[model samples]
Target: MTDAPQTNAPEPPPRHIESAALLQGAREIVIEHAGQCYRLLVTKNDKLILQK
Candidate 1:
């Protein structure tokens, strides 16, 4: 009996950023993509909401 060889590759780690750093004291920020505008908002409950 012969064993098969493994050829698995390691994955790169994901990037992380703090919400405070991204928002920079702003309650909301706009993001533009594909000629469209989107809003990223910090809600009253302190949750994030994305809208187009």
Candidate 2:
């Protein structure tokens, strides 16, 4: 019996962002997409939440 060859999936590119630079002391940021507005918020737990 012959063994099958193994293949690995391609990896995605890395992304980097400086949160302080984007937020700048703001708790929330407004995003416009497809003519709609959404809110990206930073929670007290230092996590992010997005809402429409």
Candidate 3:
């Protein structure tokens, strides 16, 4: 074994954001059509919403 020099640097995570995971978020949505009410389940990453 040989001694090698190493640099101390931080590495960024691959795929920093995921779309599927967004569905499991803390958000509320309200929809009304005719006589039906819909509450959409959605999540967001920073500013992008996973569900409409």
Candidate 4:
């Protein structure tokens, strides 16, 4: 029996999106998943926080 040869393949880069696009001029936005709600907030420090 002979084993198959292996090959190395490069992975694609991850997708990127701007925070302004997601928030759309809002301080917070709600996301729904698995029958649950989550809040994505932007603080005064210009950082992001995810809450359940």
- Residue 38 displacement in candidate 4 (angstroms): 0.4
- Candidate 3: segments with Cα more than 4 A from true spot: 1-26, 43-52
Residue range 1-52, candidate 1, lDDT tens digits: 9899876978779879898998999999998999999999999999999999
Residues 1-52 of candidate 4 have per-residue lDDT tens digits of 9999876877779889998999999999999999999999999999999999
Q: List the residue pairs that clash in candidate 3.
A: none
Candidate 1 residue-pair clash tally:
0
Report the CA-based lDDT of candidate 4 relative to the real structure.
Answer: 0.95
For model 3 the TM-score comes to: 0.29
What is residue 14's positional error in candidate 3, in angstroms?
Answer: 34
Could you estimate the TM-score for every candidate?
Answer: 0.68, 0.62, 0.29, 0.70
Lowest summed lDDT across 10 adjacent residues in model 3 is found at 43-52
Best by TM-score: 4
Q: What lDDT is reached at residue 26 by model 3?
A: 48
Candidate 4 residue 31 Cα shift, in angstroms, is: 0.7
Q: Write the per-residue lDDT of candidate 3 for residues 1-52, one digit (tens) a residue.
A: 9978887887877766454454355465555778777665543444543232
Worst 10 residues of 4 by lDDT: 6-15
Clash number for every model? Answer: 0, 0, 0, 0
Candidate 3, residue 35: the lDDT equals 70
Question: If both were scored by lDDT, which would come out higher, candidate 2 or candidate 3?
Answer: 2
Ranking by TM-score: 4, 1, 2, 3
Predictions in order: lDDT: 0.94, 0.90, 0.55, 0.95
